[model samples]
Target chain A: MTDRRTIYLDNSATTQVHPEVIDTIQPYLSEKYGNPSSIYHKGREAKEAVEDARKKVADLINAEPEEIIFTGSGTEGNNMALKGIAFANKNRGKHIITTKIEHKSILNSAGWLERNGFDVTYLNVDENGTIDIEQLKKEIRSDTILVSVMFANNEVGTIQPIEEIKDILKNKNIYLHTDAVQTAGKFDLDVKELGIDLLTLSGHKMHATKGIGALYIKKGTKIEPFLHGGGQERNLRSGTENVPEIVGMGKAAEIAKKDLEKNRIHLKKLEKKLKEDIFRKIPELILNGHPEKRLPGNLNISFKYIEGESVVLMLDEKDICVSTGSACTSNSLKPSYVLTAMKKDPVFMHGSIRFSIGAFNTEEDIDTITKTLPEIIKSLRAISPLYNKD
Target chain B: MYSKKVMDHFKNPRNTGEIEDADGIGEVGNPICGDIMKITIKVKDDRIEDIKFKTFGCAAAIATSSMITEIAKGKTLEEAKEISKKDVSCALDGLPPIKEHCSNLASEGLRKAIDDYLMKKKD
Candidate 1:
């Protein structure tokens, strides 16, 4: 195998587990492997660890420890937030409102609620992928029980106006849930300040292991149990705890909270340099998502007349990893709904690529990408039938 | 998820670019659908003397374009027209099921190029 260093720029998809997190989880997997449900010494140790993890995760988002409920994944958290709230408050209302640009988890959950006898309204987004507040105000009805919006988009990294949305739903008895899976570690999330009734966060997105996620539910929020069993997670989510991964996620959250500002500064610097270099070297490209109010590490751009999958493979050949929103990369053979909702041209949608930086990246990595990407784009455009320089 | 052969051809496409003074040219697919192939050929004694292609598509599209040119090079116009999508895909070891359409575009582009030449001669 070639010894070329692999440059991973797909942090938004999932980050590499941090060394500190791995170290923190090692003891739980071996020496302290005990069921949290047991009353024995090992069990108590495991239980204490789980509770400590909950506190760390809760602290990361400025939520109370009791408000944190660990789940299998961000998908599960989203499902629990949507379905739990919907079933419990069916008497209050059967209407739900969400955006068209939400992740599949949120969109699909809304769809499931729709099929199961609920009214749903999908709000449209502007060219920058920001939802309109006036439209939201018109859509919100007395019967509307919950309004779910992602804090930041997964593909485009557009930060939604959650505070304004919260203000609109204030004291209306309508619960607001924000899928903060992308924003959990990158941005400071104040659940009390934002007035978010429910929030979802994924562990793997913030350098923790997969198969672990957390949902923050404000106190006094009435929600039904998503899983019914041995009454784990305060009976809201019932399952034997995944001790190792939970501890890892907790440690990840601790590190994230401690280094949030530093990481954000590093990521913003890298993102700015990368964008500047790419825009300077390339022509006929359009940036996707909000120019200012976006995730620091996310850089989504569409190169005209070239397909994204081709560009991705070309980059991979050089040991650089990135993601694309092109239909060719997906099984559905349809381009990214996020970009489509933004009213991007279908042609440009086919050419969209997302580069998400992480803490592990350095200036050298950015330099390598800046040096290598242009050559790949040049070669691809040379053979592209649609690209005529004249 | 292309075969190694497909990746190889994509990395080093053969007979790329346009034949400025070609006898005929063929273009297939569209940007909306995300795959487009343009082929140009020079005919001599009813045989494809020189062939070139430029593609705007995924890995499968570029590989299939290169594979078709390699398969049809020096073949008579009649033989080149008979080349099927299967021939192009099989020459590249095989494409993914979704990408089989890319091979179809390559063969169709070749046939259209040949048809263009024949149509011009009849006039």
Candidate 2:
């Protein structure tokens, strides 16, 4: 505990809260604690803090402050976007379209709409986790009300063509929503330029506090509120605002905006080096997802004959935390559906590992992984029946 | 990491190819999720003469199936029927929580296929 020699590579899951963000919210947690809904000087201070955070969030996405609505988490934001947009646009269409590789948040949101009398079509992706724009165009019907695809896949890091989606939805009133949880802090994202009508952002994914997120709705977009109560967030979201987290999220957004290019370049360099080393050391490794249409901080590879879960446990013992597509859905029995949808062989699917990098990662960490992974993969593959026996 | 027995079975499994003209067989699991095994057994004179397998599965499934068929070879039908998933996994020196189900399904499939082979012999 005292040594502080830790390497955190699971940035997609979440990040350590920024010290500045913590400082910004400390006073609100202690003396300045007042409900933004209350009418007084202290409450007014809280209200101003909330509004300031709202403005920061909107600024990050290049949207107006009035368009931002604070929510509980990324999942809530996705739900409000999907369900809210679908319910409001039902007079226009009865079908909704999304991809197979969205986060559980968006996937489940689409599922909820399906059960409530709306027909939903889940678009398939190619081996690189890229959806066909033409196929999406063909699927979009007069009855199609919304097209919700994630900006970047959380598991595989495939960047969707949000601009192409925009082009497809140019004339239609169908809203285009994206769950940009993984891409938020890692990439330069502007909702306006991307033509995203509805976008979701999670706080913890970007070094802010957990249990806090926001959704961006275009000025004229009509979305029925999912959580209804007092007129907070323009009567769309109920309950008192978590002023401290909103402030922290705004600070996180500011930090993300300032550090985007530097982190992107650094992580890209590390990614290229790691891939080259992995190819040189373990040449049989196949990189999953799109080659260039992927996140700079994410590297997923499949060691031909070993098991991913075994590699995870071995690396965990060495204090190298990784996941075998270890999503909350089926972290136990199944490999990643994202990889599976990519049409990877079962042998490779069973052997894939996701090594995600973060802001704190260094060249030494990449070197550590490059050095340790090949040996571990070699040992595991040596014992694997697929390699040794067959 | 796994015990040497499990590792060996996984490393150099015996009788891994499929049986084209076998008396009985069973296939279990989906390839997209990893772990698919096709086990085939030949019954002769109330005793299993040959057992073979083909698996597009994880190490544990392939190892456990290879071990089960090894243990079942030349054994009586009733004895092979008594083979359990726990026995298969134990012989391979235990599996991770996730892959253990694959072994269980393999055992269940082996037992079912043998039972089907035996009941057919009665006709």
Candidate with maximal TM-score = 1
Per-residue lDDT tens digits for candidate 1, residues A1-390, read 212499989999888999999999999988999999999999999999999999999999999999999999999999999999999999999999999988788889999999999999999999999998899999999899999999999899999999999889988999999999989778999998999999999999999999999999999999999689999998999989999999999999999999999999999999999999999998889999999999999999999889998999999988999989622236655678888899999789989999999989988899999999988888889999888873
What is the per-residue lDDT of model 2 for residues A1-390, given as tens digits with 9 covering 90 to 100?
A: 111365567677777888889999899899989999889999999999999999988888889999999999998999899889888888888899998888877788788778898898888899999987888989989898889998888777889999989998998878899888888777778887888888999999888999899999999998899677888988899899999999999999888888889989888888888788889988577888899999888888888766676677557556777777744554556667777677778778777777787777788888887788877776555444355442
Which residue pairs clash in candidate 2? none
lDDT of 2 at A263: 83
TM for every model, in the order presented, reads 0.97, 0.82
Cα displacement (angstroms), candidate 2, residue A263, comes to 1.3
Best by DockQ: 1
Over 4 Å off in model 1, which ranges? A1-4, A326-329
lDDT of 1 at B17: 97
TM-score of 1: 0.97
Runs with alpha carbons beyond 4 Å of true place in candidate 2: A1-4, A330-332, B1-33, B36-83, B86-123
Q: What is model 1's C-alpha RMSD?
A: 1.9
